[model samples]
Structures are given as C-alpha cells and as structure tokens.
Target: MFVENLGIVLALTGAVLSALLAGIGSAIGVSRAGKAAAGVCTDQPEQFAKVLILQLLPGTQGIYGLLVAFIALSRIGLLGGGEIAALTISEGILYLLACLPMAFVGYFSAVAQGNTSVASMAIVVKQPTQAGKAMIFPAMVETYAILALLISILVVNAI
Candidate 1:
C-alpha cells in the first residue's frame, strides 16, 4: 500500500536525520565550548584567539553532516537528476542505512569533542604556551567524524 511512497520517505528521512542530528550535536557542542571560551576570555583576554579556535572545533560535525546529506540527496535524485519520487524502496532504504553511521557517530563525536575542547581550554588557561598541544586533545575526536563522513560518502556514491 505505502510501498510507492516508502522510497521517498526513507530517502528524505535519511537526509533529514543526518543533517538534524549532526546540527544539534554541533550546536550543543559549540555552545558548551563557547561558554568555556567566554569564561576564559573573561579572565584572560589574551587567550581569546586560542579559545575561539577550540570552541569552533565541534563545528566540523555540522559541516560533515551537511556534506553527507547533500551527497545523499544528489545521489537519490532529490537534489538533481530525476524526480525524488522516482527512488526505489531498496535504494532509499540503502541510503538510509548508509547514513546511520555518520548521523550517530557525528552527533556523539561532536559533543565529545566539545567537552574535550572545554577541558583543553583549562590547559590553555593555565599554560598559555601549551595552547598548540592542548588543541590536539579535541582535534583527536575529529578522527571518528571524518571516518564516518568518508564512509557515508563512499556508501552514498556506491549506491
């Protein structure tokens, strides 16, 4: 009965979830890091540059999510090619499943990265000279997001 519509539903669901979850994570993560940055900046105005960079670290997840959503939408003909209604149930489901890893991982990693950045901000607060080293901690969390992005892109392209 709903089979004809299921394809578009699944495809749209995947695209929406990928962007929505990742954006939420980035928003929360950036907010937390921004609060930490504000606290640090209030104490030491000179640390603003370092803290700002750290605070922005989690934003990459949102960009990754957007990329995946764009690719998925394009591949499934929602953004280009034919009409979105032309997608098959199997193809839509495949796209949906392919997006799950990035959606889940991106959300969790961004939040974790934000927390890590906040902790790293403490390091920057005390040891200003070690800001470069401190940045590495939060940067490490980005690995998983990038991996997830890569996998999602590959899967979307493969489909």
Candidate 2:
C-alpha cells in the first residue's frame, strides 16, 4: 500500500513539476516575444502575422509538457484508480531523476528560443519571406526538449 502511494506521489509530483517547468518556459518565451513584437509593431504595424507566428513559437513547449504529463498519468493508472501504491524508493528516485532533464531543458530552451524569435522577428520585419528561415533556431531548441521528454518517458516506463 505504501509503495503504491509513493508511486502516486512521485508520479503526481513529476507531472506537476513538468507542467510548471513547461508553463514557466512558455511564459518567459511569450513575454520576450511579446516585447519584441511590440517593438516591431511600433515601427511596422503591418507585420502582425509574422510577429504573431514568432511569438507563438515558444508556446509549444507547454503543450509538449502537458502531453507528457497526460501520458505519464495514463501509464500509472492514476486517473481511474481510487488509490495507488507507493513506489519503491528506487522507483521513486528514478522517476524524479527522469523528470528533471525535461524540466530543465524545456525551461532554458524556451528562453533561448524566445531570444531567437525576437531576433528573427526583427529580420522578418525587414524581409517577410525569411520568416521560415528564422524559425530554425527555435526548432533546433525544441529538438532538445523533445529528446529530454523522450528520455523521461522511457525512464518512467522502464520503472
């Protein structure tokens, strides 16, 4: 019983932590992108479409985290079960460790992507067609987040 409860606790903790990390990352990224967009709009108000896309780039991480959490929850049977057993200490520890990389990577990647988007936005204002090219940086950062998420999921499943 205790072991099941521990599993539930660890899983919930991991889900919440992952969500928080992704949410915070998106928030920061959006904020940075918003600021940049505002700056661009001041000079070129017509580039709204381009700027909006740039601003939205950083928001994807939050969705990724949410998906991961949902996957984890489903895997652990937390949603349907009335009570769960606690995990073994080793399992709990493993779960925690697995969650860390995604949280950290998602956070910093979003921030970095935000910065990249800001720079890209500036470029887009000058050359609208180049916007796609500008997205490469954020896409690159997203790869790391994806990798982290995959690792976390694999680890969780293994436990």
Candidate 3:
C-alpha cells in the first residue's frame, strides 16, 4: 500500500508543510513584532492601533500558507475524497516541489517582516505623527510574501 499510495502521501506532505512552516514563521514574526509593540505601548498607549496594525503585517504569510495548503489539498483529492490514483509519483513530487516556495519563502519573509516591523515601531516611538509613514517600511517586505503566495497558488492549481 505504501508504494501504491506514495503519491497521495507526498501530496499530503506538501499540504501539511505549507501550513506548518508558514504558521511557524508567522508565529515567530508576530511574537517579535508584538514584543516590540508592547515595549512602545508602555509609554505611548495611544499608539496601540498603529502598532497593532504593523505587528499584523507579517501574519499574512501564515494565512496565505493556509490558503495554499487548502487549495493543494482540495486539488489532490484530500479535501473532496476524490482519488489517490489520480496523482502519480511524479505528480506527487511536483506538488511537493511546488509547495516548497511557499514553505521556505513564507518562513523567511515573515521573519524579515517581523524584524522590519520592530524597526518601524521605533518610528512610532519617536514620531507619532509619522506612524503612517513608518508602516511603509514593513509593508514593503510583504511584497515577497505575496509573490510567493501567488506563485504557489498558481503552480498548485496548474498541477
């Protein structure tokens, strides 16, 4: 059965990794940003909303990871109970390879965005009036996450 069902197993592995790796990254990223926000809010409680928004920026990758995993799972019949035979070993490897981009990129981008968010929070501390401008710095890091999400989605769907 292992040989016969290898494809479905691999496909499921991909789906799980997409969610797992990205979620881990987001957790770390959010934790970093949250710690920074908490430090800033100690003195400037009024800036809660601004810092909260900034802290959430890195979290999109986790959500995107879930989306891609769901799509891949659904495509591979894990969601609808379609059929294991529909996917060959080659297709399973393809699915696994396709998911790698989201898994790795999401992980790195989230950590980077989190660090960026922390730095951005410093702007909130110094120039409350420029809080809006401060967001731009972390927001820029989101582009890579978006690109990874789009590519993963496109490739998983195509496969």
Candidate 4:
C-alpha cells in the first residue's frame, strides 16, 4: 500500500508546497508593505486606497499558487470527491516538477514585489501624482508569477 500510494504522496507534496510556500511569501510581503502603508497613512490617511492597492499586489501570487494547485488536484481526481487517479512514480515526479516553478517563483517574486511596493509607497508619500507609476513597479514583478502560473498549468495539464 505504501508503494501504491507513494505517487499520491509525492503529488500531494507538490500541491502542498505550492500552496504553502506561496501563501507564506504573500503573507510576509503583505505584512511588510502593510507596515509601510500604515506609516504613510499615519500622516496621510487619504492615501489608504492607493497604498492598499500596492499592498495587495504581492498577494496575487498566493492566489495563482492556489489556482495551479486546484488545477492539479482536480486533474488528479483529488478534488470533487473522486477517487485519486493512480499515478506512476514518473508521472508523480512530473507533477512535483511542474509545481516547483510556481512554488519557487511565486515565493521569490512576492518578496521582491513587497520590497518594490514599500519603495513605491515612498513615492506616494512625496509625489502622490505618480501612484499609477508606483503600481507599475510592483506589477512588473507579477509578470514572473504569471509565467510560473502558465508553466505549472501547462505542465500539470499535459501530465
């Protein structure tokens, strides 16, 4: 039974890591940005809406991670109450590998975006007119998360 279920275990590990690591990264990023935003808001409450947007930017990676995990789980018959599809070890490894890009990239990108977001908040502090441009900086970091999402989706679906 252990041998039979090893594939499921491996695949589940991938899903868990994707969700857990990305979620953790987002949590850290949001906390850091939120702290900076609160400091800014202490003097300028009017900036809450703008800073909120920037603070939330790092969170999308967690959502993307969840999306990929959902896709993987649904495909593996682990969602919707279906019996888990019996996967060979090689196929399970593929699932693990597929998830790694999102897991690793999402984690790093979110942290990077958070740091960028904090800096962007500084722009809001001095020149509120450039809030749009401030947002663009963090959004740039999102591109890599999107790329990882695409790769995970394609690879998991391909499997």
Candidate 5:
C-alpha cells in the first residue's frame, strides 16, 4: 500500500536533505573562501598554505552532514545491508526529524564559517603573522556544526 511505502520515502528524503543542504552550503562557503584566498595569493603567492587552510575551514560542515547521511542510510538499509527494515510512519518521521538539525545547522554554519574565513583571509593579507588569530574566528563557527552532528548521530542511533 502507498502508506507502507511512505516510510521509505520519508527516510530517503531525510538522507537526501542531509547530503543536499549541507553540500550546497559547503560549496557556497568554499567558493566564497576560495575567492578570498585567490585575492590574497595574487599579492603574495608564498602565503598559499595559510589561505588554503582558511578556505577549507568551512568545508567541515559538509563532511559532518555526509557522515550523518551515511549513518542514516546504513540504518535504513539503504547502504549495504542485505535486508532493509520496514520502518513505520512514526519511525520514518523520527528519522527525518533526526536529520533536520544537521541539515539546517550545517547549512547555516558552513556559510557563516565561510564568511568568517573570508574576513580572516583579509586579515592574513594585511598582517600575515596574525593568521593564527584569524583562523580562530571561523573555527568558532564549527562548534555548532559539531553539536548538530552529535545530535543527529544520537537521534539516528536511538531510532
């Protein structure tokens, strides 16, 4: 029946959302950071390492999202299990809800982290020695993404 299949659909949607939203956010964040990195590198090519590190800072959210999605997919038997569990509607909804935190938080945090990275890159351009301080700003944004990841993981495991 259609109702029976709805659970699978919901599970799939959660997996997709977890990957898609976070991926998009990381892409945007990386792009923004890359631009700033390029601008800095244009003037001082030798500082590429610092700029690259800053540019990559926002990408952690995407990884966390992927981790959550992978775990969810495996839980739902979409990954590699020989048999898939028949999840009830409530279970499906639970799965979807579990993913929501990571999806939303990852998306927002990555973008914010990216902007912070860009600003940090600007600082690196002006005062190269201050790169350490600059990195701290964006690293702070990563805390929320980690928290979301933890929540999603725990929720999915519980379900």
Candidate 6:
C-alpha cells in the first residue's frame, strides 16, 4: 500500500513539475516576444501581423507540455480510477529526469527565438517580403523545443 502511494506521489510530482517548467518557459518566451513586438510596432506599425505571428510561435511549447502532462496523468490512472501502481525507483526517477531537459531547453530556446524574432521583425521593417526568410533562425531554435517534447513523451510512455 505504501509503495503504491509512493508511486502515485512520484507520478504526480513528475507531471506537475513538467507542467510548471513548460509553463514558465513559455511564459518567458511569450513575454520576450510581446516586448519585441511592442518595440517593433512603435516604429513600423504596418508589421503588426507578421510580428504577432512570430510572437506566437514560441508559445506552443507550453501547450505541448500541458498535453504531455495530461497523457502522463491519464496513463497513471490518476484522473479516472485513482488507482496507483508501484514503480521501481529507477522508473520514477527516469520520469522526473526526462521532464528536465525539455523544460530547460524549451525555456532557453524560446527566449533565444524571441530575440531572433525581434531581429527578424527588424528585417521585416526594411524588407517586408523578406519576413519569411527572417524566420529561419527562430525556426531553427524551435527544433530543440520539439526534440525536448519528443524526449519527454517517450520517457513518459516508458514509465
């Protein structure tokens, strides 16, 4: 009984930690992007649409993390039956560890991407048609976030 309760605790901890990290990361990203957009708009008002889209790109990581957390919770039967199973210490640790990388990567990458997007918006101010090209750097930065999400998902599944 104690072991099962421990498993439930570990699983809930992992899910909550993962969600918090992702949320914080996305929050940082969105904040940076919004600031950049505001800065850009102050000068070139016409680039609002492009800048807004760019700002929104980094915000997706939080959503992905939330989804993964839901999956993890569902897998552990926390939402329905509330029944818990015993997990090996290693397995529980792995689940927690897996979420770390994604959280770290998502946070930094989003901030970097926000900076990149800001630069891109500056470029757009001069060459509106080149906005697409300017987005390449931010897109590249986003790849790591996707990778982190993949790793988190796989780890959760393994647990």
Best by TM-score: 4
The candidate 3 region of ten consecutive residues with least summed lDDT is 77-86
Clashes of 6: 0
Instruction: Sort the candidates on lDDT, descending order.
Output: 4, 5, 1, 3, 2, 6
TM-score for candidate 2, please give it.
0.86
Those runs of model 1 whose alpha carbons end farther than 4 Å from true positions after fitting are 80-82
Each candidate structure's count of clashing pairs: 0, 12, 0, 0, 0, 0
For every candidate in turn, the CA RMSD to the true structure comes to 1.3, 2.3, 1.1, 0.6, 0.8, 2.1
Candidate 6 Cα lDDT to native = 0.77
Task: Summarize candidate 5's per-residue lDDT along 1-159 as a digit string, tens digits.
Answer: 989888878987887898888888999999999999999889899989999999999998889889999999999998885688899988899999999999999999999999999999878988999999999999999999999999999999999
lDDT of 6 by residue, 2-39 (tens): 67466566767777876777777778877887888898
lDDT by residue for model 2 over 21-52, one digit each (tens)? 98799899989999999988898888887888
| Model 2 accuracy (lDDT, Cα) | 0.79
Q: Give candidate 6 regions above 4 Å deviation.
A: 1-4
lDDT of 5 at 91: 89
lDDT of 4 by residue, 1-159 (tens): 988888877888888888988888898899999999999999999999999999999999999989888988888889999788998888888889999999999999999999999999999999999999999999999999999999999999999
- Give me the runs in candidate 2 sitting further than 4 Å from their true place: 1-4, 81-83
Tens-place lDDT per residue, model 1, 46-65, is: 99999999999999999999
Model 6 is weakest, by summed lDDT over 10 consecutive residues, at 84-93
